[model samples]
Target: MTTYHFVGIKGTGMSPLAQILHDMNYNVQGSDIKQHIFTQQALEERNIAISSFDKENIKADQVIIAGNAFPDEHKEIVRAKELGLPIYRYHHFLGEFVKKFTSVAVTGSHGKTSTTGLLAHVLEAANPTSYLIGDGSGKGMENSEYFVFEACEYRRHFLSYEPSYAIMTNVDFDHPDYFKDVNDVFDAFQSMALQVQKGIIACGDDPYLHQMQAKVPMLFYGMNDNNDFQAGNIQVSPEGTTFDVFVRNSFYETFSIPGFGKHNVLNALAVIALCHYEQVEVSIIQQQLKSFKGVKRRFSEKVVGRQVLIDDYAHHPTEIKATIESAKQKYPDKEVVAIFQPHTFTRTQTFLNEFADSLSQADAVYLCDIFGSARENAGDLRIENLQERIQNSHIISEDTIDCLTGHGNSVLLFMGAGDIQKYQKAYESQLAS
Candidate 1:
């Protein structure tokens, strides 16, 4: 058996691939910077050895899978080249591996992780399924018949895949650091849509997505009658959301999921459409959809005293709005407090007002300093600029996180893609004291 080495095993996408290979009974080990990330917990549970970065970690009898974050100049890459061992970029390796089974690529600017998790759960009930979810979740069956994975559109990375089917959640302007504007982002998804081998299941509500022109057959799903797969008669209560599916304006089934927000409904609808197309039993689809426990760091919740602390990866303005809406839907009686840390300086600078407007939807708001990258290290943007836009918004640090304790019976949304969890951790420690 050949050993598989992941250059950056703790990454959201890389970690899951490592887990999938590990579950398949492959010899797997990886090297990273030694900082503890949430993804490492799953790797640790499997006893996958992870060590600090060293060129010596690479051996003669290994196939190296490097995360896209690492470049040719990375020490491990240099060593892998010296040995003339096969080295595959993470996406390139996934693209090849997916060809072995009936593959479904879930891609979007937002909701990819949540939708991928939902689909994976539903599909596993219908067939022997393997999945790679963005929240660092993966499972492999030795005789798997279906492969479900999340494909990101950033830098056109999703174009690396040629899936039999795709679930396009939406196309919204994001990642200002890379693409020039929303049209640039649209062009990238449009290019990816052309690569689907069989069909595409896309959300029809998105103006950009509904207009997508692809060679493969497309089914549009949404909350309105305008879509090929539509969900209507929706109701939301504390328990969850209930909606009826209409296929070609005909009633198909009524499904209820223990998740709130129109985004969640649309996500479930996308999965339902794909499962329907695949001939999955409707009973199995409904059961697994409701039983999905959710992915890591995407609205992960814990209760302490009178407060509900939710850790979510809602870095974009659109995602922030959806998360806040979900919180409101689930806990209408409680105050929804948003503790937001802007992920990147460029993104904060790009969507400054948009972020402020979305965050203002919450009952109260708290802002954390921007988490920046070295590539676009210098920027005029500041978190105070965002704080200035919202009335009564507080600027907070991990040291002063105790201020959140004042919001009694509140739903605290710890939202961001960066190291925002540190603030949550600090606050949790405050509660313990």
Candidate 2:
């Protein structure tokens, strides 16, 4: 049996890849820091062996898969090199692995995780399917006819994938540490679009994506009439959102998803377009969309007493606005409080004004210190700089729990891509106590 060893296996993307390989019956074992991450639960449930990082873990016959965050000098990587074991970076290996199946790559600035998860759930229900989601979830079946995966654009890593079908959710200026501007981001997507082998499903509502050039046949999906696949007659309630899907001005089916906001409706439209292209039955698509519990950290909600606490991975300004809008749709009569922790210094500096504008959409706002990245140097930027921009906003700290207690019958949205969960978890414990 071939053994696959992963270094830094607890990472969001790495954990899922490890799960997929393990499910495929590969002898998989790896090491990472002993910190208790939510991803570790999935690994433990599968009885996958996980150990503290040690160079001695490297074996001669095992193929090494290294996480992108690790440097070449990482002890296990160094040992793997010394042993002359075959090695691959996470993205490169995923690129090669995806070529074996009829793969669909979901890529964009946001909504990739939810869209990928929804697509995977829908396809797996109707047909044999294997999927890799960015939320530390993956499944691999030996005889799956399709592979659905989230293709991230950060550092242009998604260009490594050559999927048969690609879904471009939207193009926006993000990952400021890597890409210079929106045009730079667009260039990366355009290059990847040309590489799609079969077809492309893109959001026509996005001005940037509407201008993309692709070699494969392109299908547009959105609320716009110009889109080849459009969603009309939308209805959003506390339960979910319902919309009628139209293909070339003809009514196809009315689909509903257990999600809120126009953004999610657009996300469903993209999936609907792809499934329609593949000739999936309308009933199956509708069933799967309604049944999907949603991806972790993307608008996950928990109710405690009269308060509804939402945890979301919405660090970007656009994502923040959408998350707040979704909260309003779900709790129309309740105050929506946003507790935002900016992800990286570079992103905070790049979209400072935009962040303030978006966070203002909430009824109440709280700011947490920016989550610093080792790769970037923080200059003069601070969370206070953002707090000053929004009127009546408060800085989050140890006193946050006491301050939050003032609001009753409100949705407390803890939003960020980093350790903002710590704040949420801390507050939840206080609430319980």
Candidate 3:
């Protein structure tokens, strides 16, 4: 058997792919800087060994898979190239690995993780299904007829995939580091839609995507008259959201999901549409979606005393707005307190006013330190810069978790794509003490 060594193995996608490969009885081992990340727990549980990045770890016969977060100058990757070992980019490897199975790629600016998780859960109920989700969830089956994976459109990386079935949740201007404008973002999705081998299920409500005419049979789903699958009469309760799905202007079935927001209702509709196309029984899909607890950190909730704390991986303006809207919908009576950590310098500078506008929807807002990635850093951009644009937004540091200690009966939401969990842990520790 060939050995596979992943160079930055504990990434959200890399960890899950490592787990999937390991479960398939492959000889797998890897390394990462974030060795103590929550995703690391999964690797340790499977007895997968990890070392700090080292040139010595690159053996002669092993395949090296590099994580996207790391650059070509990464120690192991550079050493592997010099040693004549076969190297693969993260997305390149995934594109190849998913082709053997009937692949379902879920792509969008937001909701890809949640929709992918829901679809994987629902499909697993009827047929053996394998999935790789951005939430660091992955599983392998000895006999899986289908593979469901989250396809991100950032940096136009998702173009590497040609899925058996592709689901476009919605398209919007994002990844300001790469794309120039909203039109640039739309062109990428249009390209993705054309790459699908089987069919495409897209959100019809996205005004930009509605105009794209494709060669594939595109089934539209949303609360719109033009959609082939429409979610109507939506109701959001404490239990979840319930809506009737219509196919071709006729009532098909009523579906309920244990999730909040109109965005989630549309996500459920996308899953329902795919299930119907795949010929899976509707009852099985309905029960699975309703029972799905949720993907990790996508509005994950915990309670301490009278305070409800929610942690979500919402970095962009659209995502932050959706997460807060969902929180308000689920816990209507509680005050929604938002603690946001801006992800990257480029993203923050690009969407400063947009971020300020979306964050203002919260009952109260707290801004944490900007989390800089390995990529670019535009000059002099700071959290205080974004904080100045919003009303009643306080600058918070991890050192003063006690400031949030007595948020009596408030819904404290920690939102970001970066290390915002540090703030959540600080708050929880303060409460514990």
Candidate 4:
């Protein structure tokens, strides 16, 4: 058997895919930068060979799967081409690989990762399930009955996948780098919806998704009675949130999740709807939702002294808004302090005002410098541009992280897609001192 080699193996999606293949007893190994990443722990636990990029890493017996972030000009990719080895882009390979099992593709502008993780956990109790979560989690079970994976809409890569069913949480304009506008993003999702072999489970509340046309049945789930699957009689407390599930205006059952926010309730609704259709018992779904530990860096929390520190991946404006709301719900007595690090120049420029409005929802706000990835160059915008829009928002750096301690037991939400953890790390070190 040919060994599967991954380029840029430490990436968010790439790490989990490598882990899944390794679990299946495949010869999995890869290369990346010498710098350490949190995702590398999973790969190393499996004893997968991970070395720094070099021409020697490529051999005639290897099958290369190039990460989306890397280009053909990279040394490893160049070496693979010279040797005439089989090469596959990450998305292309995943599209073909998922066909082997009963697949459910979780797609949307947001909530894909959380919803995907929820589905995998719930389904595993009912069937032998394999999953690829965006939070760097994946497992390949022997004789797996289903394959559930997170499918992203960046650059229309999700269209490459043809899953049996799809759960589109919502369709909002994100990834401003590639998509020109909301309509452009909708067009891509519309194309993806048509390709589903089975029915589609979608959030009916989204106006863009409501306008979508597809040959497959569009099953809607939301808080409103108009939806095929609805959540009503909601209750939220410090423990978590509970709501009644109404199937076509009649109560099916009541469920609780160990999480706050309406967005989370909707995520559970999508999972409940899909599993109900598949004949999974309501008791199993309820149990899994209640016990879900949640995905990494998504409202993940810990208590440090008096302050509540949370790490979340809320790069987009809408996601930032939801994160703040959840924080407020969980700790109504404390302040929600947002420490936001913008991911890319294009996204920051495109959603500058929108970002300001969302961050202003918090009791206090701190802004970090924009993180530029290898894919794009610096734009004309600066971090101060966003700071000026929000009244009294402080510009923070790793050196000034101590200022956060002054908030007096506030819920500090460290939100970003980039390396905002370093700021949290800096604060933790100061607290230790």
lDDT of 2 by residue, 193-294 (tens): 989999999999999998988888999999899999999999987789999998999999898898999999999999999999999999999999999899
Model 4, 20-49: lDDT tens digits are 998888999999999989889999998889
The parts of candidate 4 lying over 4 Å away from their true place are none
Error of 4 at 7 (Å): 0.9
Stretches off by above 4 angstroms in model 1 are: none
lDDT by residue (tens digit), candidate 3, 1-433? 6899999889899999998998888999999884388888888999999998778999898999999988899889889999898999999999998899999999988899999999999999999999999988889886889999999898888999989999988888888889999999999998888889999998989897688767778899999888999988988778988889889999999988888888999898999999999999988988898899989989989988888999999999999999889889988888889999999898899899999999999999999999987778658998889989999789999887678765687899999998999899998887777
At residue 320, what lDDT does model 3 achieve? 92
* RMSD in Å for all candidates: 0.9, 0.9, 1.2, 0.8
The number of clashing residue pairs in each candidate reads: 0, 0, 0, 0
Residue 345 displacement (Å), model 3: 1.1
Q: For model 4, which pairs clash? A: none
TM-score of each: 0.99, 0.99, 0.98, 0.99
Q: What would the TM-score be for candidate 3 when compared with the true structure?
A: 0.98
The models' CA-based lDDT, in order, is 0.93, 0.92, 0.90, 0.94
For candidate 1, write residues 257-374 as lDDT tens digits.
Answer: 9999989999999999999999999999999988988888988999998899999999999999999999999998999999999988889988989999999999999999998886
